[model samples]
Target: MNNKSLKRWTFLDTINAALLIVVVLFMLDFQNNATVSWILLAVFAFWIVTVILRNIFITRVMKDPNHPMHPQPGEKNNAKD
Candidate 1:
């Protein structure tokens, strides 16, 4: 990826982090002693954990190859045919 793409990805990462924090906080504030509240909280927890792990693993792969996030048009054309 070029500098521009890298910057865009960084922005996306920031948004994800913010949303995760909001979800966690929502889980805490939810005032219901029902099964549904518990289930929702668990789902949010799973999503947050998965996002963290995926970012860690994918980041390594992304750096190994140039244009990890995006390829030039000609480069992708070669793979198609």
Candidate 2:
């Protein structure tokens, strides 16, 4: 991957990690509460779905020829142009 893509992934991963920590803290603070457990479960599910969507977006940006990540002239054509 190029430097730009690497940076993007790193930034996203940091954000995701921070969010996970917040969720874990909430879980700890509200231990044994049935309502809190259900809320946490829904939040966790939403987080998973968002991560999957982010991966799909990153893959498309890297692979789509029309994207700025596309190779320059005379360079290797990894994309299915």
> Candidate 2, which ten residues in sequence have the lowest lDDT sum?
1-10
Evaluated at residue 31, the lDDT of candidate 1 is: 59
Writing each residue's lDDT as its tens digit, candidate 2 over 1-81 gives 352322234556678778778877765445568787678767777877876676677677766768776555666643331
Candidate 2 ranges beyond 4 A from true positions: 1-32, 69-81
Could you give the C-alpha RMSD of every candidate to the true structure, in order shown? 8.4, 6.4
- Model number with the top TM-score: 2
Candidate 2 local lDDT, residue 40: 73
TM-score of 2: 0.49
